[model samples]
Target: MKRKLIYLFFLTGSFIFLSAQVGINTTNPQGVFNIDGAKDNPTTGVPSAAQQANDVAVTVGGNMGIGTTVPTNKLHVNGTDPLRLQGVGTGNSTTDPLLVIDANGVVKNIGTLGALSIPSPAVFRLETAQNNFLQAQGAGGAQVVPMSMIKNSIPGLTYNAGTSTITFPAGTYQITFVYEAQHNATGCTISSYFVDFPLNATTSRIHSTGAHSEGALSNHGGTITYATTLPANRNWTISLGRGQSGNCSGAGMNLSATSTQILVFRIGD
Candidate 1:
């Protein structure tokens, strides 16, 4: 009786070793290692594709497949919701990229690119309303151009009508200001116009148009554009007035001028 039991055990171990395949809930294994999760695989022959839906397979070549018998890649999953990852923190920034796939199907982050990417710009536009005039400041003097209406503006900018100022965040910005006006007094003329805005606490950039002389009741226009990087968050005083070298003293300009426009665009941080 002992010799018979030893012979039976050896035969069972030889069968398990020689088969070179293992199956759970299945007698006919489709891969080197397979698990029929639903226990509905066919008792004989191969299971249909529908019956193989609830299955996990590991091929002899070390390819793993979830819900598939034949995997094309190292790890292939064939389901509507195939894979999911958990425990990913909630931090997202340009410096720390989330996940981006390259042209060759390789995953990468911003750190791989070795540069900090800039975000899209925030734009704000302010225009004069009907019957609105830009306040006329004499030579060497500047006054904020009051914006009566907001044509189109984005967030992150604060506009105060009473102060006629805009608070800007720390970033590189491109500012554009344009205005058209005519002198109201007879024999009054302006040699030039300029824009004054604080680049920083100690410095202010002036953009002046060249020689826009106009007689009384003569219409004139000026456009100034400048780009600068601010080191800190501060208020920008958008002022349009006559330059110091102009003959605009004792002359009223911007009378009922409604063609003023101010555009502030934040390019990058």
Candidate 2:
């Protein structure tokens, strides 16, 4: 009867061990599961990954690893608050105004915190508007006159004596000329003449025809009148002679007389 009791006790102990082994195997089918490294804990109702042990608690002046509570008064290389430097012109001026990434993944210029110290005489040039002059009238007409014709013995007065063919452009111009004659004796007559012609080669002339034999010498002046529009470039000459049939080049005609003749030309729109 004692032998039977021993056998039954041994059988009970063997069954208990086998059941414990079976339960352990059923709980973790994968053999790779580690009891210490498992995220789930069966005791204390706390997850192994979420709860921190008493020994793992962060102490003063201790560096906190990732997933751990940070210590008080500890310097965080990459903390929530930004790390800033206090000074002026303490960086590489060549590569300064640099945009660097902060601890929070924000990009900002390092130079914005302080006043920048730059070189002097940094010029900022600006361009100004220029004034220009344009020629409204082209090269034609009395635009082509001899230099000798625009002069006078007196300073203010200008005289033109020679014959010049004025080829006008395709526009109308008021042509004027002054003729002065100082008659020392009577019967001295002076004539100022002008001719107007069309592009078709038609011609006209303005002159004075009368005899003056009075003792009292008086200055008589009259202007020539004619208005003809030019269809194309044409030529017209002014000839000043002494007497009728007296050509421009003749002796005793005084073509170079001291009396003045001024040719005034004005252009209008």
The candidate maximizing TM-score is 1
For model 2, the stretches where C-alpha displacement exceeds 4 angstroms are 1-163, 183-200, 209-220, 241-259, 262-269
Q: Pick the candidate with the highest lDDT.
A: 1
Per-residue lDDT of 130-186 in model 1, one digit per residue for the tens? 232323456666666666546434235566667777776566667777776665554
Expressed as tens digits, the lDDT of each residue in 1-269 for candidate 2 is 00112122366446422211111212321111212232333433333335222112223345432222232323223233445667856653333465787765556675621123221111111122111101121112112122234322211222322444444433333444333332323344432233233323665544543333433433433344444444335555543333232121111211222233324321211
Task: Report the poorest 10 consecutive residues by lDDT, candidate 1.
Answer: 1-10
Runs in model 1 deviating more than 4 A are 1-99, 111-136, 148-155, 185-190, 212-216, 255-258
